[model samples]
Target: MTFDRPHDLLKRSPANPLIVPEQVRPSRPDWRVDCAFNAGVVQVGDETIMLVRVAESVAASAPGELRVPLLAEDGAGWRCTVESLRRDDPAYDFADPRMVVLRADPAQVYLTSMSHLRLARSTNGTDFTIDDAPFLFPSTRYERFGCEDARITAIEGRFYINYTAVSDLGIATGLAVTDDFRRVERLGLIFSPDNRDVCLFPRRIGGEYWCLHRPAPRHLGTPEIWIARSPDLLHWGRHERLAGAVPGGWEASKIGGGAPMLETDRGWLQIYHGVDAQQRYSLGALLLDLDDPRIVRARLGRPLARPAEPYEVTGFFDNVLFTCGATIRDDALYVYYGAADRVMALGTVALPELWAAMGV
Candidate 1:
């Protein structure tokens, strides 16, 4: 499938990138924000609440030196430690701007930056006010590397958040819920290593809770969207593939769940991201059977949105548009997306237009 930067059908906010790295204050004085994006958004009362991922680089060091932040095992727990390594050390490789790898031991890869979730508040859903400190910082051994991209699912009177936890152990998924954004109750690691991009359904179905997750492949099989159910929110089982990538298609490389599924009259509307051969990220829609979510009722043949504008085409990782959460207001679907994994932006489409786009 030829992408050629397919134009997104939604109407973008004139404000465009509503939130940037500079607008946020790093948790530590020595750290500087690299990028702030991939926020999990929700509408609470009259304000739009956003939990944005903010990745920061350590302060510059002496000439020829590199500072590597690590979580060292401290007896029964872990503690933050910074190690200094020569930039030109023969034992290390820094080809990728995202990380530094020990040449002889690739598994000893270290991120050049650490990410934390920041809370931002908006009244009109466009302009935002970012908090001075990180809303959610990496503290557990599982999140030694950092806590990144979060997806929110509001159920009952509380908000359920499933986020990616990065560590040397492996990329995994964790769960946390909040009554107010101020304090949270962590449920620890919900999905094992090499699994992420998780979203919990807003409500229970068939007297059980459901979630969408992506389990990565190391040696065999391809990365695809999968579904799981749980009696209690902490444990998940009964896993099955919900959607897979299409070879030579728009989603030829891989596909993963995006915003939590939106319930409609016809089915559960799910927004997901697709990566092509060039690693370009775009958005698509999948309508799942209302009663049986495992059944895919209809799918959007083309991307609902793709990297087109300057923001989407350039940044830390170019040609990417990713959304962790979306909300509906006055029949309009508000899509909060991250541009090139660098900044946060918003787009909107009428519910009717989206339904027609998917031909459902």
Candidate 2:
């Protein structure tokens, strides 16, 4: 609760990972995005865009054999192999730094984590530019195994975006609207598999349309947070499971809801992240029901931020903290996370007074 901010807003970025891939695969290496992500801010004419969530990964030398090699134009440059992989299948599972459950073939798996939706820009909220192509890729078929953590609300006039799609027919929830992020307007595979961190509740209540999801139950427990209903935020429904897992503290190993929830006044604040009992990762706060956002009027046993810096204690997946986007403006909020999955940083705190010191 003492997070005051500024010390250069948690320093250390001697260009740390900054943006990888000069050559890995034909050309699209890895931008890696899952947590500490962002999307939708837009002003365009004046500045402040931010669409990030790259995650590309495709490199191989000859060692274990999982290819993505390319570069055959015939004008001279050639490598070939286009695509051909196998990490032993069985719904796949290769762990260590590159973490890939890719579902080798539960019946038709097709995800290997390649997401794409880049572009950073910024004019007054610290320096940034990014964008070398990719405003959203992996086109259709529930993202063909790409796209992750995207939030971005805006509503009514466009800019919906609710992400995390993965493939092989699992881990769903996808939608895309966009206004000027160039173009995006997919809205496929609403919510399936074990679901994902959703959000989407930036207006509309009694009239329907609400979101916030999670649903990862397969051993029965943790990964809670649900709630549905929609007159058309893309069909939705009355689902409702709403928050769980605060039981013995720091989220007892499950908790979600980050970004796009924030309504204020004293409810619908939500800035979740929890996961403890050694899974580390923090940041919490909840206060729903701005007209039944699934009730849960207040909760925040601890953690408004944790993972005590070192660029969030090491990278490419270390003791991470994760966020996926945030942006309040004036009184400060900013928060953009994604440190240990390797890179992307910018944190801030001050709005709703960090949710009344998390006793919200």
Candidate 3:
């Protein structure tokens, strides 16, 4: 029942927050970065690269104006259009600082700021050099609201990225392929609306590519992890429930895939995130069948990592420790996560120790 605390299994870097909003400049002059978090990490030669989600807010605007950015369909070209709503307007509800919703139309909600992915490179796993401009921005109508929580998997010498695309249609998974990180090709939306937290397996399984995703149902079932298969990576089918929240544990409310599943001798080592009833986020592990990833071999009853340190316990969102990706080198697993949804931090765990902690 009681598992070892996260601090015992995973060791937090003494440097703590490796990246923060002040460490990286905004992509544009008019925009100010509010937070830089939820980065997908990859190893390029000797460098550690992170595709970080940067949330930006516009400069001072007119009083009582709630400015929001959305993708514009002007027929000329793809661009960002800022829409302003008055705070005193009776039709709108601005009770949530994160988003604004229309009182008459509950389904219509808009984020307060625009989000984009940026690049940050580190020689060691701790300190980083962030790029001045955004590496990936909102281009298509599906990502009009923003592109967030990217997970990268290297397949056949090419890197394929799956990210959460947000819009009025809802949150969906979008795909991008790149031989080199310099130029990326957008593959459009792969999964439909109300689905997110998708991570594609690095290689094919049983002649079919596999992906782990979460589909959140509004009125019927709770949000749970699911697995889907595809032969060509575009059209996905054969959906099966992989895992769901445990009733009396840390992941009581919802669960989703975190990093891409890591292949090990025992099975497919999957690191995932779970939200408790209090909305606190933590990380856990799942051992899935190597031949048939749909079958869950074993799952950690308790979290492998959770918000413990001061940095992880406070910021944009409190008690949050979320990771999009991680890198394994030698005998150590380097976990790069978003701390409190405001900054990036690094945690290191020995492979043997982590396996032991998970009882694998």
Candidate 4:
């Protein structure tokens, strides 16, 4: 629960940080570039499609040793990271450059870091027009440590991405398919290591193919919300546990699955992400069972968005707001948060006054 930075919303974005970090490397070290803060969005044709997850850093010739790098860009802007240190096993150690894991030697440890899932375009969603190439990367093997966030969905017409692969053998959940995002059809890791905050459930009930996961019970407790069933979205099963964590309220400290639910007649309206116990991070809501969406009818004690602006408190991991994606055209509800992971912010409510202040 310690946070500090130059903050004031870092870049504040009149432009520069809507998403920056073009592409940097040992090209001399010290200009700054780091990305990936939950991404995925789609509207297609008329424009409005992004799938970012870009992170880049490099500097570690010897002294103390440190070199962080990651890339994956597609928006007429090219940048890719990962040449291969192949898990440099001088013995193995790197839980984020020395949080502690030991044993490094796979030819001098230079994997740098890798991730892929890029493609940005917009027709006034907030000025953007990129795409020189790179729609998906990290070609399998559970993705050699690349690709994060992404939860597009789309269904019926076909778009169902799932993202978050990462490697060395952990964070898995990859599957892809497209109609014409320029042809992509890879379906590998369905949901492996410890699971992630999945999505999908734009439509489909008794017929199957519902989703919304977050299976990390590391300490053997907390971090809940589950529900599966996929006749073919990649073979999931009936596991249910719709929601949890609300002991003292404001989401007691865990919850996930945001954007991509909104239907609201009185059901299927979700907008998760809540944390407290000092972790901060906010935004919450639930009201399922539009046909047994694992049945959690009402929820929302407080927090339709917290971490009071100033770009949600600070940077790199401060108060945090963290949203994967959002959009609701007309009556407004275009929240695309990420602020505090570094940048990116666009707030709006009035979607029936934010679900009537989330007290439905």
lDDT against the true structure, each candidate: 0.88, 0.63, 0.86, 0.66
Model 4: residues >4 Å from true position, as ranges?
1-36, 39-54, 57-137, 140-146, 150-161, 164-198, 201-207, 211-230, 234-269, 272-284, 290-303, 307-320, 324-338, 343-360
TM-score of 3: 0.95
Worst 10 residues of 2 by lDDT: 18-27
Clashes of 3: 0
lDDT string, candidate 3, 1-360, tens digits: 122346446688999899989987987787789899999988888988899999987766799887887788879666887888999998888887678998764568889878899988888878898999898999888898899999888887998888999988889999998888899999988999999989788899989999999999989987889999999889999999999889867899999999887888778888888998888889888989999998888887678788987778878788888989888899788888898889998888888887776677
Taking every candidate in turn, the Cα RMSD to the unseen true structure, in Å, is 1.8, 19.9, 2.5, 19.9
Instruction: Report the number of clashing residue pairs per model.
Output: 0, 11, 0, 18
Task: Quote the positional error of residue 337 for candidate 1 in Å.
Answer: 0.7
Question: Which candidate tops lDDT?
Answer: 1
Candidate 2 lDDT over 132-180, as tens digits, reads 7777666555555567767777777777877787654567878888787
* Poorly placed runs, candidate 2 (over 4 Å): 1-56, 61-113, 116-137, 141-145, 150-173, 176-186, 189-205, 212-230, 235-282, 290-305, 308-312, 317-319, 323-339, 342-360
On TM-score, the leading prediction is 1
The estimated TM-scores of all candidates read: 0.96, 0.30, 0.95, 0.31
lDDT of 2 at 130: 68
